[model samples]
Target: MIYAVGDIHGYADQLDRALALIEADGGPDAEIVFLGDFVDRGPDSKGVLDRLVRGQAESRNWRFVLGNHDRMFLRFVTEGQQHDDRIKSGLSWMNPRLGGTTTLRSYGVGGPDSPAFQPPRGKVVETLVSWWTNQGNLSDQEVIIAAREAVPDAHLNFLATLPLWHETDDLLFVHAGIRPGIPLEEQEEDDLIWIRDGWLEDDRDHGKLVVHGHTALDTPEHHGNRVNLDGGAGYGNRLVPAAFDAGEVFTLWPEGRRPLVPA
Candidate 1:
C-alpha cells in the first residue's frame, strides 16, 4: 500500500506522529507521498524541514509536492519577495493567522523579546498590524536578511527542487486540486498549489484519483474523484496520513485505521 500524508505546516511533533503511524502501517520503507506546505504557520518549520531534508538524504521512500506557503517561505528567504497581494499588503506572511513569524522564530531570526515575536493581542496586535501594513518594506528588511542567513543552503535547495506533482498508475498526488478538464501535464503551477474555487467545486473526473491537501478540513474527505487529507495541521488540527490500495482509502490514526468512504 502507498501512503499519502497531509500538509504538515511546521508542527514537528504532529509530523512525527504521522510518520510513526505510516511506519507502523507500511514499515520504514513504505512508499509515501507528502502533500506539501512544510513551512509556515506552526512553531517548528525549521524542524519540519530538517526532518524532511534528512529523510530525503537518507533515501527514504518519500516524495513531496510544493505548497503555496512553502513557496512563499522560499521566495521571502531567497529574494525578500512576497507573493499573494493579501500578504504583501496586509501583515504579510508574518500575520498571526498565517504564522510565518513562528517559523522565523524556529530559525532564530527573531528573539523572544523582539517586537515581531510579540503575541498579537490588544494593543500589541494593533501595533504589529500597523507596523506590518506594507510588507517587503525597509521596516522588515532586517527580519528578511536574518531569515536568509539563518536558513540553511540544504533546506533551500530541497525547497527549490520540490516537484509540483507526483503520480502513479491509479493516483495523482499534488499540494492542491488540479484544474478540471485540463490535462494533468498541462495544469498550471498556480492551480496545482493555490486553486480552490473552481477546482474544489467541480466534480468532474480528471483521469486519476487526485490526492491533495491544500484546503483544510476537520477530517479527511473522500469525494469519489479525490481524497483530501489536509485535516488542518497548520491550524492546530490533526495531520492525517492516508493509506490507499485498490481504490480504497483509509486514514492511519493512532488508534487504528479508519476507512474514508466517498462523500
Candidate 2:
C-alpha cells in the first residue's frame, strides 16, 4: 500500500506523530511519499531536513517531491539571495510574506543589524556555519569544518538533483497544484508552486490523484478531483497528513487548537 503526506513545514514533532500513526496502521513495507515543503516557518527546520535526509538515505521506497520553499532553499544556497527574479516576477511579495523572512532570520540571514553587512557572501557562509554547528549533531568542530569543506560539491549536486515532480500508480505529487488547461508537459513550475484558487476550482482530470501542498487551506479541503493537504501548518495552523490507500487523515494542531477527526 502507498501512503502520501502533504507539506510538513518543519513540524518535526507533528511529523513524528503522523508517521507513528502510519506505522501503527502499516509497517515499513508500506510505501510513503511526502508532498514537500519540508522546511521553513517553524522552530526546527534543521531538524526536519535532517530527518528527511536520513529517511531518504535509508529507505528505498520513500519519495519526496520539491516544493517552492525547497526551491527557495536551493536558491539561497546557490544565488545567496532570498528573492529570485523568476519567483519575484511570478508573485510579487508572496515569498517574503509567507514566513520566508522569518525563515531566513532563523538561518541568521537577513536583519538590519546582522553581521552580514558588507559582503552578503559572508552571511551565507555564516548561516551555513550556524546551521552546521548549532543545528547539526557534529561532535567536534574540526570534524564539522572538514565535513563542510569535503562535501561542498556534493551538497550543491544533491540540491540541484531534487525532482520537481513525481508520479506514481495512484497519485501525482507536486509542490503546488498544476495548471488545469495546459498539458502537464507544458505546465510552468511557477503555476505548480504558487497557484491556488483556479486549480482547486477546476474539475478537469489530471490522470491521477493530484496530491499537493502550498495553498494554506484551513482544513484538508478537497476539490476538482484533487486533495489539498497544506492545512496551513506553518502559519499556526494544523499539520495534516493524508494517507491515500488507507483512506486515513491525521491532523496535529498547536497546543490549544481544536482537533479534526482522525481518518
Candidate 3:
C-alpha cells in the first residue's frame, strides 16, 4: 500500500501522530507520499523539515509534492523577497494567518510575529501612498540571513527537490488539484500548486484519481473522482493520513484502515 500524508504546516507533533498511524497500518517500509505545505502556520516548521530531510538521507521510500507556501518560503529564504502581491500589500507570509512568522520563529529568528510587523486589518486606504504606508513591514534580509545559518542546506535542498505531482497507475498525488481537462504533463505549475476554482468544483475525471491537500476541509472528502486529504492540519485541525491500493482509498486509523467512501 502507498501511504499519503496531507499538509503538515509546521505541526510536527501532529505529523508524529500521523506517521505513527501510518506505521501501524503499513510498517516501516511503507511507501509514503507527502502532499506538501510542510512549512508555516504552526510552531515547528524547522522540526518538520529536519525530519523530512533526515528521512531522505536514510533512503526512505518517500515522495514530496510542492505546495505554494513552500515556494514562497524558498523564494524568501533564497532571494530575500516574495513574489506574491500580498507581500507588497502587507499580508505577508509572516502575517499570523499565513504563519511564516511561526516558521521563522522555529529557526530562532524572532520579532516577525510582533504586532508592529503585521498589517492592520480593516484599515481603509485613501490613496496608493497611504496604502503603501499601511503595508506591514518586515525585514526579509534579517530573516533570510538567520534562516540560511540556522536551516540546514539539506532541508532547503529537500524542499527544492519536491515535485509538483507524483503519479502512479491508479492515483495522481499533488499539492493542489490539477486543472481539469489539461493533460497532467501539460498542467501549469501555478495551477498545480495554487489552483482552487475550476479544479475543485469540476467532477470530471482527470484520467486518474487526483489525491491532493491544498484546500483544507473539515474532513477528508472522497468525491468518487478525487480524494482530498488536507484535513486542515495547517489550521490546527487533524492531519489525517491515508492509504491507497488498487484504486481504493482508506483513512489510516490506529486500529487499522477504514474505507473512505464518497461524501
Query: What do the candidate models score in CA lDDT, each in turn?
Result: 0.83, 0.60, 0.80
Arranged by lDDT with the best first, the candidates are 1, 3, 2
Write candidate 3's Cα lDDT for 1-263 as tens digits.
Answer: 69999999999999899989988888888999999999998899999998888888899999999998898788778776534542334455555567766887788766533533423357421111111111234344545566677777787888888899998888899998888988888998888898888988898877888899989998898998899999988887988999997767899877788899887
**Shift in Å, residue 55, candidate 3:** 0.7
206 Cα displacement, candidate 3 (Å): 1.0
Tell me model 3's lDDT, rounded to 2 decimals: 0.80
Give the range of the ten consecutive residues with the poorest summed lDDT in model 3: 125-134
Per-prediction RMSD in angstroms? 5.2, 7.6, 4.8
> Which pairs clash in model 1?
none
**Least lDDT summed over 10 consecutive residues: which range in candidate 1?**
126-135
Say which prediction, candidate 1 or candidate 3, comes out ahead on lDDT. Answer: 1
C-alpha lDDT of residue 95 in model 3: 57
lDDT of 1 by residue, 55-81 (tens): 999999999999989988888889876
Using all chains and alpha carbons, the TM-scores for the candidates as numbered come to 0.88, 0.70, 0.88
**Superposition TM-score, candidate 2 onto the true structure:** 0.70
Top of the candidates by lDDT = 1
Compared with the true structure, the alpha-carbon lDDT of candidate 2 equals 0.60
